[model samples]
Target: MIDLIALRRRLHRHPELALHLPETRETLLEAISSLGLRVETSTSSSSLAVVVPGAGPGPTVLLRADMDGLPVTEESGVGFSSSNGNMHACGHDLHMAALVGAVHELTRRREEFEGDVLAIFQPGEEGAGGAELMIAEKVLLTTGRKPLASFGVHVLSFAEAGMFYCREGAVMGATINFELKVLGRGGHAARPHTALDPISTAALIVQGIQTFVAQNSSPADPIVITVGSLRAGTAANVIPNTALLKVSLRATSSQTARDAYRKIAGLGAAIAEAYGLRMTSEVGPDLGPTVSDKEGVELVRQTVGDLYGAGRYKELTVPEMISEDFSLFLEETGGAFVLVGAAVDGTPHQLPTNHSSEARFDDSVVPEIANLLAELAIRRLNIASETNRWA
Candidate 1:
């Protein structure tokens, strides 16, 4: 059995920021090497892929865990507090520990498996699209081997520990971030009639965007448009020339995401025109939705059923509006992304949400996660072999 507490403590002490997870990467690589697995760096600092070569030729299975920490202060009160301002608010520390535990188990039982297993320790999953960067560096093609399928799991604080959740289609929402800048003539506060205030234009844009979401999106289809930040005048006696608005758009489907983006841009322009201000809207790349493969989902569900019985696993009726960069990996290899429960009794009555400073992960579920991942890899490899034998 793997010492999950030690692994989590190590990750907690060495919190790595996005694209700069050298310390965490080195730690994970060292652990993989200790397990007798050959480790390969992604040529970039964003990812590390380890391979445990099997005895025979079979389908290669890939298991992924995100390694980057969030830019939040530590408030969990654990003895292993992060020295830096960053914290593992998203339970990435638990993710790394669970994967390491799985690796340890797989290495011990390596003879039972036929094909090689790839363990992906990825960074920048918070928002920087580290998975995409890893793919660009050919992280998937480790040791010149391509994965037949991949699997990833995230710990959900809302559910009770030892339970697992997954769904067939659209498991997570697509996200698009944008910034709107409204430029106008600046003047003294007393001379409001002479100068155009961009703040007014920005306010109109925010209201218009909210109305657009209500009017355009279908009731059955979930969509969220939030203006997280707004900045305008610096001084009370001056009307600032520029106003900046930072917005995030989320939808279960790509079409919904596209529609929301179009509407937001149109509304910004219209609001600016009505307020006599010049509006410049910048849209960032879309972090597409997490669409789980049907077969892969069934495989994960069956594995969970075998471990926890059929009634214990629940299929989510609706996709979560929260975003994850792991969707990028699923998009590439056509795999499944699961949400593992991490709720614990006697702790905080209400578990803090991800990215919150007070967010605490239930370490008790680490072993369950390790078992699920190892079983998923074994099952996928066996299924592939059976299919090939029939062919």
Candidate 2:
């Protein structure tokens, strides 16, 4: 059995940010080398791939783990708390440890597996689109190996430890960030008739947005529109010339997401016009939904059945409203992303969710996660080899 706690500690001590995972990359490369695998670093700073070449030519399987810390500070009070304000509040440390454990276990049981396993340590998953960068560098093509399938695991605080949750399609919601600027003439606050207060207009716009969602969207189709930040006046006596509003929109389906965006944009424009203000709306890059392939999900389910027992796995019926950058990778290549249970009890440390400053995880399930990753890779490679033989 691998010492998962030790691995987790090492990663927690050296958390990496997007495009700055050199220390984390070095650590992962050293771990892979210890397992006697030939490791290849991407020319791009965002990724690294480790290949454990099999005795014979067979299918290649890719297992991915994102390596980037969030901007939040750690309050876990553990000895390995983040040195800088940046912390692994999203459980990327556990992900790296689990992937390393899987590599170690697969190397020990190399004879049981027939094909190569490529472990990808990708960076910039925290809204940076690092997966796209890695793929652009042709990490898959350069390996001279095409993956029959790919697998990834995410730690979940909502479920009990040792239980794995997965689904066939749309495991995560679509995310899009937007900003609205409301511009108007400025004057002294004492003379209300002299100035067109943009703050008042912005407030009305915000309220109008909520009403728009309620009136436009169907009750069954869930959509969330949150105005996270708003800025307007600098001083109580002066009406600012401009106001800015930053909002995030999320939806289960593409149509719903588009509808929400349209409604929000239209509402902002209408409210600004009614208040004698000019509005400019800007939309940010899209974070696509995590849609699992049917065949890939079935493969994961079967592999988990062999490792654990039948009926131990549960397929989530409703897709989670949470968003993940891993969805970008799934969009490029068919793959299955799973959520592994890591809940804990005591002072309710689990009360804090991901991105929360008080977020914590049950470290005991690290070994199980490692085992699950290895099994998924082995099974995918086996299926690929079988398909090739028939072809």
Model 2 per-residue lDDT tens digits across residues 10-101: 88876778867888888777666656667777666747788866666777778889999988778877777887788888888889999999
lDDT of 2 at 14: 68
- Leading candidate by lDDT: 1
Off by over 4 Å in 2: 216-220, 232-238, 346-350, 389-391
**How does model 1 score by TM-score?**
0.93
lDDT of each: 0.83, 0.80
Off by over 4 Å in 1: 345-350, 389-391
Instruction: For model 1, name the residue pairs that clash.
Output: none
Q: What is the lDDT of residue 214 in candidate 2?
A: 76
- lDDT value for model 1: 0.83
TM-score for all predictions? Answer: 0.93, 0.90
